[model samples]
Target chain A: MTAESNITWKANFPDSFLWAEWEDEEASVFFHRGSGETLLLNPLGAYLLKTICSEDISEEKLAQRTVRYFDLPVDEELLSAISVSLHTFEQKGLLLSSASQ
Target chain B: MKPLDLKPGEIARLLRSNGLRLQIGPFAVSLRSRLRRVAEQIAFFYGDYPRIEADAFVDFHIQINNPAGLRHWVRPQAIFSFDGFKPFKPLPEDQAFAMFEWGLNWCIATTSHQFLITHAAVVAKNGQAIIFPGEPGAGKSTLCAALVSRGWQLLSDEMALIDPGDLSITPVPRPIGLKNESIAIMKNYGDETLVGPPVTDTIKGTVAHMRPPADSIVHADRDTRPGYIIFPTYSAAADSQLDKVEKTRALVRIAEQSFNYHILGREGFRTVERLVSRCPAFDLRYSQLDSAIAEIDALL
Candidate 1:
């Protein structure tokens, strides 16, 4: 595990996020009022942001939650994908992270 | 009273004097032009539109006239001014009428903040509207014209003014602007007499305006709820196809096509969300107008 993986992250503007999802589709659209950015998210990206919006979580925990949520087997590939998504969300200013104590 | 009620000399006199005030959709526009072609085309294309009284409030005061000094005689240029400020550079005098149509589009897109505006063509049937949002040369105007010729009501051929409050599309029926071969295609498909003379050598290249159906202008006050959002692409090699589009993808595509999406901010996002949520979207690719029209007719 890398040091970046230990950081805890939460949605940057939890209250400012407006989301719309359809029952039959895996993709969803969200608008971030703070940044005034609208984004379309695939199923995994949508699930990750939604999970993080509820509470702060470490990358390891997030990967585990994602695995359990999607009913996928535990694997390093899943963990690496989750790490990349976390950093991508951080780069987009959609997620904020802090050092875990 | 409609513009058709006035004689040719009277239309010219009104335009040269205090300006011809006409109620276009929801706004009252006062147009003053010394150019004879502008006055004539206004009467030809907008004959069914209601004329506002001289004393009534006017939303836009527009003037199209020759530029001052030697440029007016040398190159023969026409300048478009909103109020007193000229917003665009002068074009050739032959393009004076096209300039008026484009200038009015600019005036409405910039000033109308109450509605979420998209650079799309809107057409209606059975109280439901289908919005075709695409960039220029995407054949939106061609498709819109073809549909209107087949008994569909033409809401607008340029922009879709969507009410944010209820997501209803406000009708702003205007002459359909056709370019290149689309102009010739529509001429043969519909009433050739309804089309204005083709003006060539402008920025858009060989453009003409098709008068909206008389019934469309008469029913301009009626707004329709959004029924479908379709992105159309005209390809000579492709067969007519209307494929389903996911709602989230549709929302993003529509936001990209909107003229005032960023201006309306959160309200714009919410309004578009409501629109996509309610209306099913499709990606339509077709070369044949009849087949395309048939596919669309099957939608509603």
Candidate 2:
């Protein structure tokens, strides 16, 4: 187990976020009412944000869920991509992280 | 009664005296101007618009006049005022009519928070409307002028006023503004009589306005459902093409083009969301007006 895998992540203001998704399109539009900011997210980014909004999850579990949800191979590439998205969401003030117990 | 029903002299008298109150789409504007050019242009371009009574409620009280100083006689300048407050600096006297048109657009776009306003050109056929949202020099007005000439109703050549409640676009059909090469292009493409003489050396380069069709003004009260949202780019080297835009990207693009999206906040987001979800969006690139019109016509 890696140290990064134990970090838990969740939406910063889950109640203030609004999402609009079209089934035919791979992208989604999200609005954060707390900051009044609108952002465009790809399918993977959207799924991670949505999952975090529902409940707090550790990085390892998130990666496992993402792999199962997208039918993606569990490898270093997928883990790296998910890591980048999580950090990006943290930077955008859309998500926050903490050390897990 | 329409402005055309009154003689030119009467129009000028109303403008200089108690002000000429005219019904322009959803708003009533009272215009007071001492300039002969301003009076003449209003009579010429806004002839189809209905004239309101002196005692009626007015949405915008506008005035365009020569500044009171030596500047008035020397270089000569036109000043635009909204409800007696000057919102912009004085411009050259020759640009008074253009200033009036631009000033009215500012009044609507800035104050009318009742609707979500996007910086777009809208034209409709058979009760369905297509919104062309683009920046300056993107040929939106040019395309709008062309479409109107081909019998489409001009909802607006500048702003798309979307009713937040219903998501229907309200028609505020006014004169279609043309700039530079486009002025000549529209002249050759449509009725030459409908196009006004070009005023050179203005802020927007050489500018002219095409008179809105009388039928469009007559049915100004009718708002149409949005059918398509198209972002147009005019590229002389590229072939005319219409490509699908994802709704998510479409919403972001339209929000960027909007004048008061931030002001409306959540309601604005929901309104734009509904609009994008309801309409199919596309990015249209074209140089030839005929082919562009045909592509847009096929969508309707």
Candidate 3:
């Protein structure tokens, strides 16, 4: 997908998902449950999912925010990863696309 | 009045005729068994358990005896009945007492929903409770037996009953099931008076039950908030070690090991989340009983 394509992907998370989390120096664990599925997420994945649930944000904005806040390398690969993660979340019914909502 | 207050002959007569009503933990149990060995064991082992009044509400009506058949003479077998329905196939006649214990556990696990029950051994010290959740061979019962003898109160040796209303653990103190080498270990490590006769060959190898301390039964209704969630692993080559378990991991493990977690669904998830958040979790491994006790004592 083009860099501009990432800017159109606004998503939301359902309220029915129950969650519990724990974090250490290396990674954070997220136990997310809803619709008969329980998913375990790493720190980056958990952050991305929680961000979507907490706000109505696009994939490009989330990636930019993540890179700025966590001081990660900003590159094409990182942007592609963010787009793929948001899509994965939508496929799992964890993220509700603005069009779908 | 305690069961001991009744003469053994009277207890036997009631078992053979009407039934003996017992106040075990929060449940009213009516047990009827004609086997003489059951009566003798009840007199010796259950003497400390107080008798529930005849008019009280009975939660489970149980009976253990040899069924009428030609096999009654050829190869006698004892059947355990709950509410007039037999849930299990008849075991050897000699396993009547053990059957009673197993059946009682089945009754509670299947019926109780007000409390979140887990397959764990719970013991308390200094007003704090430690819940030991483990599989069948995890040495939980052996650890429970040893802890209760060293001045800790035995809440229960098989089940940890957590009242959902307040999240406090209610004591259901009963006998600690010791199996195989652990039975011998408990006898050698602690006072012999704490244990009962070994019942062999029924299911989980050679099994013996250790009677709970009298003080534990006397304070059966008192509830304590959980302070620690410990998963014990017994290994002969391992040195005593207590490793910290992360909260999320601890919650998942407890839910996986619970008797009614799935049945309770979202409520079960919330209860375990609250419990794990409030209590520190650990994995303890030990080979020696004394050292294991010492490490746990240090926790309090």
Question: What lDDT score belongs to each candidate, Candidate 1 first?
Answer: 0.90, 0.92, 0.83
lDDT (Cα, tens digit) per residue for candidate 1, span B27-103:
89999999999989988987788999889999999999999989877879899999998999999999999999999
Sort the predicted structures by lDDT, highest score first: 2, 1, 3
Docking class of 1: medium
**lDDT score, residue A93, model 3?**
72
In model 3, which regions exceed 4 Å deviation?
A1-13, A22-40, A44-101, B1-4
Identify the superior model by TM-score, candidate 1 or candidate 2.
1
Residue B122 error for model 2, in Å? 1.0
Candidate 3 C-alpha lDDT tens digits along B1-300: 554578899989999998999898888899999999889878777888889888889999999999878868887899999999999999888788888999999999999988899999999988899999999999999999999888899999999999766789999998888999988889987888767888788688888888888899898878988999999999998889999988777887888778887677677878888898889999999998889988999998
Question: Which residue pairs of candidate 1 clash?
Answer: none
Residue B127 CA displacement from its true place in model 1, Å: 2.4
> Candidate 2, DockQ to 2 decimals?
0.74
Candidate number with greatest TM-score: 1
Give i-RMS (Å) per prediction: 0.8, 0.8, 3.3
Ranking by TM-score: 1, 2, 3
Instruction: Give DockQ for candidates 1 onward, in order.
Output: 0.74, 0.74, 0.26
- Model 2 lDDT per residue over B1-300, tens place: 555477789989989999999999899999999999998999899878998887899999999999889998898999999988999999999999999999999999999999999999999999999999999999999999999999999999999999999999999999999999999999999998999879999989999999999999999989899999999999997788999999999999998899988889889899999999999999999999999999998896
For every candidate in turn, the CA RMSD to the true structure comes to 2.3, 2.6, 4.0
